[model samples]
Target: MSLIQLYDTTLRDGTQAEDISFLVADKIRVAEKLDELGIHYIEGGWPGSNPKDISFFREIKKVRLTQAKVAAFGSTRRAKTTPDKDNNIRTLIQAEPDTVTIFGKTWDFHVREALRISLEENLELINDSLAYLKNHVGEVVYDAEHFFDGYKANPDYALQTLKAAEAAGVDCIVLCDTNGGTLPHEIPAIMEKVRATVATPLGIHAHNDSECAVANSLMAVACGAVHVQGTINGFGERCGNANLCSIIPALKLKFGHECISDEQLKTLRILSRTIYEMANLIPNKHQPYVGNSAFAHKGGVHVSAIQRHPETYEHIRPELVGNVTRVLVSDLSGRSNILAKAEQFNINLDSKDPLTQEILENIKDLENRGFQFEGAEASFELLMRRALGTLRHYFSVIGFRVIDSKRHEEEKPSSEATVQVKVGGRIEHTAAEGNGPVNALDHALRKALESFYPQLRDVRLFDYKVRVLPAGKGTASMTRVLIESGDKTSRWGTVGVSDNIIDASYQALVDALLYKLVKDQEQAG
Candidate 1:
C-alpha cells in the first residue's frame, strides 16, 4: 500500500455547517489536537473570506505543533485579475501558512455560468494563480471544484484544467466532488484517467451528499490517489464533508496503510467527540467507528456469543479505537446480559443465582412500564445493588409536595416544593422555590439533606430529558424522565417513570442523589 496524506478541513469547511462556529482559540486548539493525532495537513479556513479566519491564521502562529502543516484555503485568482492584484491571493500569502490550497472551476458549466469567462480564460486563471502562489508559498494544492461533474459533462476540458495546475507547479491536484453526487462505481475510471493524464501527485476531496463520501474517497485511493481531504465527524455544509473519523481507521485497520501510528489511531473516538462538543453539536451515537453504539450489544443471544468470544459479534476490538464493548439491558436481556453487566459494575454475582434471574425479570418488567436504563446505567446499578442487599439507605424521604400557582394571565407561574426526609433518626423539612416544579423539588430535597450529607452539595443536575410513552395519549401518557448528574470527578445517569411528570422527575432526582452518595462510599472504600 502507498502512503496516504490526511488533509483535514474541519477548521474550514466544518465551520460552514449550520450551528457550527469556532473561536480563534478553538481553531488553534483543534489544530494542535490534529497535529497530535498525526494528521498531515490542517486547513485553517479561508483567511480572505472572513475576519475570524484571518484572526485564526494570525493567532495560530503562537502555538507550536510537532506535526501537521497548517494550510490556508481560498479560491484561485479572479478571471480578469492578476494574482498580485487579487485581494484573496494577497491575504492568503499574508496568512503565512506552511501550505496554501486554492480551488478553481473545472466544470465547463461553472466556467461559463459562474465565472462568466471563456474556457481558455479559466485555464489561464488556474495556471496564473497557482504559478504565482508557488513562488511565494512553500507548497500549493489545487482543488478542482466539481471535477467529477465536469468530467462527466466534458472530459477533455476537465483533464486540461488539471494539466494547467500541474504546469503551474502545484504540489498536489485535489479532485473535489463538490456536489457530492458521484457514486463509488464512477470514481475508479475517472481516477485512472486522471492518473494517466497528469504526473502530479493526486488527492481526493469528497462531500457526503449521496452518503458515499467515505466510499468514494477509498475508491479514489484504491485507484492511485495518495491524499484524502475530509472533516472530523463529517461536519460541513449541507450533508457535510467526508468523515475523516471513518476514513482514518479504515485506512489503518482494513487497508493496512501507514498513515497514522496505532497509538495515534487509539485517540480517534476522543477526537471525534471533542470536535462535536466544540462545535456545540451532539455526537452521532450511530456513527461508525467512533460512536457510542459502534460496538454495543443489546440482544441476549448476541451478548451470550460475545461473552464466549467477542469475534462472534464484533468486527474489530472496541479498544482498538478507544471504545468498549457495552451490553445493554432491556426486555431482550438474558442471564448472559445480567452477568456481563454485573462484571462491568464490579459486583460479584453467580450466573445460576436466583437473584440474577430476579434482577433480569425486574428490568424487563420496568422496561415494560416505559422505563429505559440504556442511558441511565446509574439507576440500573443501584437496582442491582439493592437486590443483592448491598446498598445503603443514605436518606429516606417521608414526603414531598410541589405546588404551582398563577394569579394573573400576564405573570409566569410560580413553583414551590417542600420536602421532609429522615437521615437515621433525625427528620428534616425544607421548602424551596424554583423556575419549575421539577427544579423546585430538586432544590427542596437538596436543602433538606445538605446539612446531614454535605457531599450532596457537590452534586448538581446536568441534564434532564422527558419522553412521553404511547405518544397519542398526550397528557394521560406515562412520562419517563432521565436525569444526568455530575460532580467534580464523575458523571452518571438515572431514570424514573410515572404517570405524573413531577413524580417521575422526583424519582430520577432521588436516584441521582443516591447514586452520588453510593459513588462517594465506593471511592472511600
Candidate 2:
C-alpha cells in the first residue's frame, strides 16, 4: 500500500472553534491518543499565542510518543523584521518541538490588504521564517495560507511563495484552503502547478466552509499530495476542518493507503467520542463515519435488506471502522428490526413471538405520544426488558416533596427535597439541599438509597435535558426529561414524561438510579 501521512491540528486549530476549549492536560491527553492511533504528526498548538499552549509543549515532551512527532505551530515573522528577532518565531523555537509549522500569507490580497506589506517583503518573510526555524527544529513545514485562492488570483506569485519556502530548506509546503471556498475539482490542477513549481513534498489543509473539505483533501491526495492535515472530529473555526475520522478510513480502506494500522483504525469511533467528551460538546449523530447513526438502519425495508445482505444498505462494513450496525427501534421499525435490537440487548425472543408484536405496538404508541427511542436507547432497553419479564425492580418510590425559597435578597435561591423509598422490606427517608429543585431531588433520592446500595455513591448524574412536548398547549404542555447517569465504568440514559416538569424529572432520576442498581446486581451475579 502507498504511504499517506496524517497530521492532526485538533489542539491548535480545533480550539479556534466556538465553545471548544481544552486545558493543558486535555491537549496532552489528546496528543497521546493521536500518537497511539499512529498519526504521523501531532500539532501541539501555537506556543507563542498563549501560556496554556506553551505549557502544553513543555508537558507533552514528557510523553514518549512512539510513532508521532510533536509539532509547534506559529506564523511567519512580521514584515521588515529579522526572523530571530520576531517574538512568534523565537517562542516557537523555545518550545523545542521536533517539527515547527509556520504559516505565511501566500495570497497577494492578504499581503496587500491585511498585512499592508509589499509582495517582495511577504516572500522574504516566508523564506526567513522557514530558514530560521529549520536551524532549530528537525523539520520545518511551511503552510502556504490561502494558497488556492492566491493561485486563482495570482498564479505566479503563489508559486513563488512555495518556491521561496522550498529554497529556504523547509521539509514540506502545505497548501491551505483557509477560506474553504475551493472546489474539489480545482485541487488536482492546482496541485499539478504546485508540483511543477516546487520539488518539496506537498500537504493539504482544508476548511469546511463549502462542506467539501474531505472531498478536497482526497482530491489533493489523488493529485499527489502525500500529507493531509485535519482535526479528530472536524473541530475548527467557523464550519470546521476536514474530519480525520472520515479521511483516515477512506484513505486506508478505499484508496489502499497506509495511514493507520487496521488495529488502530478500529479505535476511530472511540477516539472521536473521547475528544467530544473532553470538549464537553455533543457528538453529531449524523457525522460521516464515526457517528452513532452512521451505521444505524431504521426503515423496515432497509433493515430487512441489511439483515439478508449487510452490504445492501451499508456502503462499507461498519466493523471496518470499529463501528457497529445499529438497528434502531422506532415507530417505523419492523419486526425484523425489533428482533435485531432484542438480539443486540441479549434479550432472547422468537421472531414470530407474540411478545414481539406487542412490544412493537407499545413502541409505536409511546413514540406517537412523544417518546423518541432513537436517541434514548437506554430507555428502549428497559422497555424491552420489562416486556420480556426479565426486568428487576430495585426499589419503589413512596413519596417526595421539594421546596424552593430565597430568605434574603443577597443570597441565592436554595432548594430542598425530601424523598422516601422502600427497598426490599425497609423504608428509607432522606432530605437534602441543592442549587435547584432537581438537584435537591437527586441528592435526597441518592441519600435514601446509598445506605442500602453503597454503589449508588458511584452513580452520578452528568447530564439532564428536558423538552416540552408539542401538544398545542403552551404552559400546560407535557415535558419529557432525559437523564444521563454514569459510574466510572459506564453511562446510561433514562427518560420520563409528565405534564409537571418536576414530576417528569423525578421519574427519570428514579429510573436512572434503578438502572444502576440492576446493573450492579447483574454484575455481582
Candidate 3:
C-alpha cells in the first residue's frame, strides 16, 4: 500500500461555508486536534486575507504540533509584479508556516478572462511565485486552480502550467477542481496526462458541487495522486469541499492506505463532532462514517439481523471510527433493538423480561406523542432509569415566573425570571434578568440551585435547539428543546417537550443542571 498524504484545509477553505466560521483560538484548537490525528499537513489559512487568519498563523506557531506541518495558503504573485514585490507573497512568507501553498490560474479562460493577462504572463506568475517562495520556504505547493476543467478546455496549456511549477522547483503540484464539475471517471485520464507532463508529486483539491468530491479525491489517489486535500465535515463554499471525515476512513479501511494509525482513527468521530460543536453547527446525523445515524439500525429486520451478526447489516465496525452501533426505539423498532440498548446501558434486563415489553410499549407511546429518543439519549436514559426505579432526584421545581416587556420606545426589550426550587428540605427563591425569556429562566434556575449545589456554577449551557412537533389538531403544535451543557471536564445533552416553547426550554435546562449534579455526585462517590 502506498502512503498517501492527508492535507486539511478546514481553517482556510472550509470556513468559506455560509454557516461555518472560526476564531483564531478555534483555529489553533482545531490545528492541535488535527495534528493529534496524525494528519500530514494543516493549511492554517491565507495570511493576506484577514487579521484573524494572520493572528492564527502567529498563534499556531506557539502550538507544538507532533506530526502535521502547517501550510500557509495564498494566490500567485499579481500580474506584472515581481514575486519579491507582491504583498500577498510577502504576507505568506511572514506567516512563517512549514509549507507555502499558492494557487495559480490553470484554466485558459481564467488566465484570459479573470486575470486578463496573456498565457505567457500567467506562466511567468506561476514560475516566479513558486521559485521565489522555494528559496524562503522548505516546501512550496503549487495549486493549479480548475486544473481538470483547464485540461478539458486546453490540455496542452494546462500540462504546461504543471511543467512550469515543476521546473520552478515546486515541492508538490496540486490539481484543484475549483468548479467541482469533473466526474470521477474523468479523473484518471487527467491524472495520467499530468503525471506524464510533470515529474513532481501530484496532489488533489476537490470541491463538492457535484457531490463527488470524495469520489474524485479517491479516484485521483488511485490514479497516482499522492496528497489528498479536504476539509472536516465537508464544510466549504458551494455544496462543500471533500469531507475528510469520510475520506480518512475510506483510505484506511477500503484502500489499505496508512494515513493514520488504528488508534488515531478511533478519534475520528470525536474530532468530527468537536468541530461541529466549535462551529455551533448541528452535526448532520446522516453523514457517512462519523454521523450519529451512520451505524444506527431502525428496522425490526435489520435490528434482528444485526443482533445475531453485525456484518449482516453494517459495512464496517462502528468502533473503527469512534462511533457506536445504535438500535433506535421507534415505531419501527423491535424487541432486539430494546435488548441491544439495554445491554449498552448496562441495565439488568432480558429480552423476555416483563419490564422490556413495558419499556417498548412506553417508547412507542412516547414516540407517537412526538418524542424522538434517537437524538435525545439523555432523556431516553432518564426514562429507563425511571422505569427501573433507579432515577436520582437531585431537585424539584416548585414554580417559576417569567416576564418580558419594553417600557420605553428607546429601550431594548428586557426579560426577568423568578424561580423557586426545593433542594433537600430547603426552598430557595431566585430572580434574574437576561436578554431573553429563556436566558432569564436559565439564569434564575441556576441561581436558585447555586446555594445548595455550588457546583452548578461550573455547569454552562452551550447550545439550545428547539423543534416544533407535528400537530394532530388544527393550528396547535408542541415544541421539543434539546440543551447541550458542559462543565470543565465533560459535556452531555438533555431534552424536554411541552406545548409552550419557554416551558420546553425550561424543562431541558432543568434536566441539564440535574444531570450534571447527579453525574458529579456519582463521580465524587
lDDT-better candidate, 1 vs 2: 1
By TM-score, who's the top model here? 1
Task: Give the per-residue lDDT of model 3 (tens digit) for 1-525.
Answer: 989999999999999999888888999999999999989999999999899999998898888999899999999999878989999999999999999999999999999999999999999889989999999999999999999999999999999888889989998899999999999999987888778888899999999999999999999999998899999999999899999999999999999988999999999999999999899998898999999899998888899998889999899999999999998777788788888887876767787789988988999998886677776666777778789898888789999999999999999999999999988898998999998999999999988988888999999887888888767643468988988888999877777888888988887888788777767866899
Listed in order, each prediction's TM-score against the native is: 0.98, 0.94, 0.89
lDDT accuracy of residue 60 in candidate 1: 87
Instruction: Tell me model 2's lDDT, rounded to 2 decimals.
Output: 0.91
- Candidate 2 to truth, TM: 0.94
Clashing pairs in 1: none
lDDT of 2 at 355: 97
Tens-digit per-residue lDDT, 1-525, candidate 1: 778999999999999888999998899889999998999999999999999999998898998999899999999998778999999999999999999999999999999999999999999999999999999999999999999999999999999999999999999999999999999999988998999999999999999999999999999988888999999999999999999999999998999888999999999999988888888777898899899889988899999999989999988998888888999988988899999999999999998899999999999999999999888999999999999999998999999999999999999999999999999999999999999999999999999999998999999787899998995887899999999899998888899999999999999999999999899998999
Q: Once superposed on the true structure, which residue ranges of model 2 sit more than 4 Å away at CA?
A: 405-413
Clashes of each: 0, 0, 0
Q: Whole-model Cα lDDT per candidate?
A: 0.94, 0.91, 0.90
Best by lDDT: 1
| Cα deviation of 331, candidate 1, in Å | 0.2
